[model samples]
Target: MCGIVGLISADGPERLASRVAAMNAAIVHRGPDDAGVHLAPGVGLAMRRLSIIDLSTGHQPMTTADGVALVFNGEIYNYRSLRAELETRGYAFRTQSDTEVILNLYHAEGMAAFARLHGMFAIAIHDQRRDELILVRDQIGIKPLYIARHEGELLFASEIKAILATLPCRPAIDPQGLWDYLSLRFMAPDRTIWAGIGKLGPGQILRRKLCSGDQSIETFWQADLTPGPFDIGRDYAREFADQFVAAVDSHIVAADVPVGAFLSGGLDSGAIVAAASELGHRAFHTFSISGDGAGGDDELPLARAVARRFGTTHHEIRMARSDYFDTLDDVVRAFDEPYGDATGAALYLLSQRASDHVKVALSGEGSDELLLGYTRAADLATLAKVERRYGPMPRPLLKLAARFVSPDRASIFRAMAEGGPGAYRRGMAAHIGWTISDAEKAAFWRGPDMVPSFDLVQGWYGLPDTAHPLAQSQQADFGTWLVEDLLMKADKMAMAASLETRVPFLHLPLVEWCQNTPMEARIGPPGQFRTKAVLRDYVATRLPDAVLNAPKRGFPLPIFPWFAERLRDAGGYVPISREFHNWISLEGLKPIVARACRNERRALEQLWGIAMFDRWCAVYAD
Candidate 1:
């Protein structure tokens, strides 16, 4: 894994080296093992290498003998296979690095080489022959790639801050992007918080011709969700288990250095360890994080059970409220954007702990999005059925009920009353319901945009072009939230600690197959209410029922209650008070803060969102 940056200028390569060097230096934490630069007449590419493979010879900004150069940031698990294929085609390679495999494959197959790739990557290949720069992100966008265009030049980087460092220009904030962040907690693709810079959407590729000044962006791939004509119903549980185990085995086998797994008390991570153990890889190292407070503590016992069962080396770290308060700046700075996910703290802590034992760690992310594993999905399905029956509710009555009712319960009623496109959009915005007032929402958001968050899901469910709702939802996520938000968090937090995180469950083939499977097939019987039912069934055979059936307590954190109780104590330490004192109404925050201290669950998430946004403004906007 590594961080890459490049500047393409029509003005020749005079300051390119110094500019690229400055950009790469900003994200040196991402790749501290080595650094390399490739400078040409009009292009400069710089890379910081973590050196997971070909430790001695894999230094990058790697170039072919013929002058084609490539800067890459990710792992190509199928490099060995691709190398063998390239060899048959008369291409010779000097190194075992996947970077070389990519350069050779590009030389041999052109853009078609992307179709053959099966790993996570964000690649920038400069074709010296064509004077063109080609940028491609992985199919699922497990890695990040950001680009900005300025005065006939294009700047690209693994992190936004790196690009900002080189240009030293602050673009206007995109209003829609700001709205999305306030409502959804993160920016969507095709939009960045910074107006001029845009994220390269997943499954998409951008190609620029330096000579002709032409640029084209297109979707190179997508998960196939069309159901197959024939049905093969032979113990899907066992078959899925076998396939999952094989996928995890393949992922772990690719690491050139010591690797480990992040073991939460949930089935996702536990299942990975169980499968790895059964695959004969003993002595795997596992890491877990726990909160010190009473309400936010973790189930370390469950994690210990899996570790003991497999006899793996287990490491646990306990973090107090003070630790979270103190590290807030580090976490916010690591993410170049204002990310509102509280789990960022937990992920950062976990990665910091894991980096001590291994260079790479297997994680269980993307499973929730692919498998309908969130409670909101099940809730949306139930509400959709109700909305179909109650299609004629008066707006005023519904609005009145929404106001008097608690936000948690009101969310359910709102979901049922607001049908069609609006329902899904509202559901998507449910997490940040505190951002706008009813009066303000009426004035600001309208038409399709005003539709509930679930409407995005509904659009997927009712896609005129697609048949599978689950698959459509996955596609939407890949386009919007997955890359711009979740993957950003994963990459930044892991790279912050100089650790590599691989998600076997996010393998393209597995996702493609799951997309085509019917929702019924994936979820099993109605009313089961068990998200990821298919995977759960697979886990049932390989893991204890307790692990498989445990409630999904996602990377738990105590931010809300901790802030409520400790805000005054953290006054001097908190980074936001100076700037936040101007815009945010602290008086308005009192009720929410009071509710959080009283242990009102739903209020806490919204309260934390406000606090996070406040701090973000202090750091970035103030």
Candidate 2:
């Protein structure tokens, strides 16, 4: 909803305000409605307000009478109740703004109160009396926060570019981060492609006591991955449906400004729109992003149908390959990294279009991760069973099949043979991502530190921590794929367009409800193999048969044909750049490029990934 920036240092308050102004200027798109700055002896805080809540009074660097300044970048869905509690404690009223409530609550409870709040927020609170800076991100990381510690100054912001304003030089690429992206298609959450900068993981808090120049990072809350008992007979589906509609109602009502939704023809967004309309909420405006047969699904037809049925105003934006290519420069720059997901390109354009009419938009983002909605979950579970039974393929056989089989399948053959959680983890990434085999990757970097996709999150949310294979994959995704890539892409694209996108599915109350879902309902029997089975059941009657029975072609941009055409148009195989030689190896790059030139679908992603990284370098590095 807003862009928040803070720089705490011995960098003289006078100079700090000037530097903060420049930094805040970079992210004006995030909050074009209003701007404010707070500067003191040891720190400066800034925020761009979009004017969503309490439009008359909602402004930031919202300060209290006691000298505490708060700059936050999300909605606290439960702020009203939290306000009531604070009022009971005799807290004086100022504005009917959540920002005021947050400052007052922090005044009452300090940083410890973050756990008691539920919302998608990136909060930076500066306590002048304490000379302390505390940064908090929501439990699921729906909002982004990047931090950098340099030359006795600590910088934190809603986007990486704002942080880059203070240090314009491109940060060096971390070899480990590159290796991780090569394996998993995304960098680790705590790590970014740029060196000397770090993304604060979801549910994390960073506190810098400027007096002592001491800082530490800790999780304010953690996911309860412990499976909840799924009872189909106990009206749980009805409960999920009711709570989900309530969540939809809550998100739309958060803003005093006109609110809209980023809708798709898919069941997720359709379901939300229907729920909103049925709940008799205010006039609903819907937005959809479609593709121009350039490796993307055109959901306009169905999106229009749903919007019409719900009696909501609808807008559609169509994107072509050329459109994507043209905007890609800005897209990668917005990413500030080599994000492998092309959906970011479409999302960037979509948010840009949506921002024209509305300031806030609801989206269907976390549904897949929460409900095991991807079709691959069943295959992953099946592969795990096969691994458990046959004890994996021989290494020689895995290598032999690597050249012929799909990259995902080849990974299963290789990783499953190794056995245990690592295999399952690797298998999960293989199911959804494109990466070369370990043997193939070794030719690029045989360093002792290269982490395999299966082992991407060994210490947290990796395969070893969960029971079911589906659960294992979900955990891995929630930690890596969702946090590092999907959420990052969503935030950047939306903020770049100056639209505040909210995810109803990620509402903690709704997520906690889905966490109790049974494995059977998630992945189900292969013949049926219905993903999000409980959710499908809930919407079965509320939605049209066309929607309920539609195939899941989520953001299905026709990228293979586009990649093939791009390579052919460029005079056959694209050559790897000198940067690739510096980081990866010509030894490994040769065959991958060769395979892609041969029109191998598996190899296309690698070539595209390299090109994306180069494009990012073209902007930030070179």
TM-scores, all candidates, are 0.87, 0.90
> Residue 120 of model 2: what lDDT?
89
lDDT of 2 at 364: 89
lDDT of model 2 at position 189: 71
Off by over 4 Å in 2: 294-297, 375-384, 387-431, 442-454, 457-466, 524-528, 573-581, 584-588
lDDT of 1 by residue, 1-622 (tens): 9999997886546677788889999999999999999888888888999989889889888787777899999998888888998898888888888889988888888888887888899999888888889899889889989999988889999998888887756776565565556555666556677878988877778999877779999888866544444356656566567668877987888778888999988888988998899999886999988787645346677788889888999999888887877888888888876777787888898899899889999998877776766545555575466456544666556656777887655654564355432353333433312343433333433223433433333333333222333444555554456566677888999999999999988887677766666565566655555677778876776666667657777766566667667644544224354655543455555665666666676655655665676677667766
88-123: candidate 2 lDDT, tens digit per residue: 999987788888888888999987888877788999
Error of 2 at 597 (Å): 3.6
CA-only RMSD, every prediction = 5.0, 4.3
lDDT, candidate 1, at 374: 57
Ten-residue stretch with the least lDDT total in model 1 = 457-466
Query: Which number leads on TM-score?
Result: 2
